[model samples]
Target: MTSAQKPLHSAFGPQTTAQEALAGRDLRGKVAIVTGGHGGIGLETTRVLSNAGATVIVGARDINKAQDKLSTMKNVEVIHLDLADPKSIDQFAADILKSNRALDILINNAGVANPPVIKDARGFDTHFATNHLGHFQLTARLWEALIKSGNSRVITLSSISHMLGPIDLSDLNFTKRPYDKDISYGESKTACSLFAVELDKRGKEHGIRAFAVNPGAILTGLTRHLTDEELAAWGVRRGENSEFISPEGFKSAEQGAATSIWCAVSPLLEGKGGVYCENCDIAAIVPADSKLMTGVREWAIDQTAAEMLWTVSEDLLHIGSIPGLSK
Candidate 1:
């Protein structure tokens, strides 16, 4: 069910690496796509899935860089995808659809954070447009391909920072209200969580299940724009020389990728969808006023908010009600 947000006490924890998450699984014959797959947590996810014999399609804004980085990997394809551009999204999805292959997994793992206010071609907030709307459109466009697989999993990365969200659909692009970077980023992540909620609700009957993942505090490219001081302030600490940490410390990129990989492949989650997962397990729900950076906030998992966000997203994209995305 979409609202089963309780933890299953999986053996895995915050310290699990992407490789560890898929330790005994064989993904041969499976196909997966990872946005920003050439770098950081996404890279780890792509590597593990490909190593397990799954074909990995990596969506990167910088095609050359992505190709170069992934050139040596087996069964990996790099495609140009500028999330802030609707045209690029259409082309990406069209390209995939043209293949006539069922897409088994889709990790909407690419996103922008902490940048100066920037807008897309349609004057939408770059954070909201690229992070939320772009992935939303891409998923919608690829709905047919996903449903082709008898059972498909869609993993969208949310954040603990979503505690600040319940996005103001009224001012999504900051057209009416003042724009604050953290708030805007939070809103985008919040939007991502809600998207999973509604998408799982609508797609489950079709053998497609969606989940939102909170990948813990990993220092990845998403935080590149942040300074050391900002990192400290945000509580995303990292050791100078470690890519794995004890459960008590911050996450490494590999560790951060675990929950996403788990969401995509773990059999334990086969019958579950729409829950917010963290530390490679379904997280508990917390009150709106909570301060701890664990568990999902009530607003982020509210069914009403999810439904409203879906409609607002469809309206903003001007895509209207479509087959897989309609409420």
Candidate 2:
């Protein structure tokens, strides 16, 4: 009866693209929601799903930008959603509930990377609050709709950075520890992946499966926080003299969106959930190799950690008693 007890599966590999991932799939009458669907990987995801006949709702903070990008899409609607604000999430969920009870897919894609250190209304660290807790609350609020949809899935946008950090429950807000922005973002993303596992364990019987996806390295607004020098130092940037790009390289926005679309609409994943995915396939459980910044870490994918983080988060957010998820 809890998400901690479910099995998981994998899909394709990182080289797969959105078009390739959804080839031969049909979403004719399904309803899906993609957060931050106006730009980068999110935009490509919106485009692919909408093209496949799914009525996609673009959850964005900037209504104008969302509409501008999705202007030509027939069934796409841009809705204002600021994840940092619980009131906004509640209002959006209420509107969705009134409009339709069956939501086939929910993509927790919108996230703030390393925005200049700021605090949200909840007085939590900006990255942790917006990236993890915000989506956590949103998913909880939308649980009813997901269950009503039958065989629905929630795909969370986690990252390889999750392997680098763990949930600092005591100092989640970074109020006491030395503020390391990258670690803060990593912690939040790790929580995102764990949350998916926990959700699948708890809601699988209700036909709600959850998956966490890492889009791999893509040059997008999400990386705007890191300066050119920092990126070069990290070996993520390319030299001007380089000829053919590396196979294991940074993906384009469309490529970055591939795994997300696959997880959202791929038939290959039916009845399989609660796994961390990348490159359009279920990433293998590799050893914690610092060289390869991929694959799910033990802690991030651990059911015990997932449940503990869930309970702590619920209490922090003042949500309901998270029954079986406590440490």
Show model 2 residue runs off by greater than 4 Å: 1-11, 236-248, 321-327
Worst 10 residues of 1 by lDDT: 241-250
Per-residue lDDT of candidate 2, residues 204-316 (tens digit): 88898899999998877776677667777656654587322333577888789999988887776788788888877777665665556876667778888888888887887
TM-scores of all candidate predictions against the true structure: 0.94, 0.90
Clashes of each: 0, 8
**What overall lDDT goes with each candidate model?**
0.89, 0.82
Give the clashing residue pairs of candidate 1, or none: none
lDDT of 1: 0.89
Model 1 earns a TM-score of 0.94
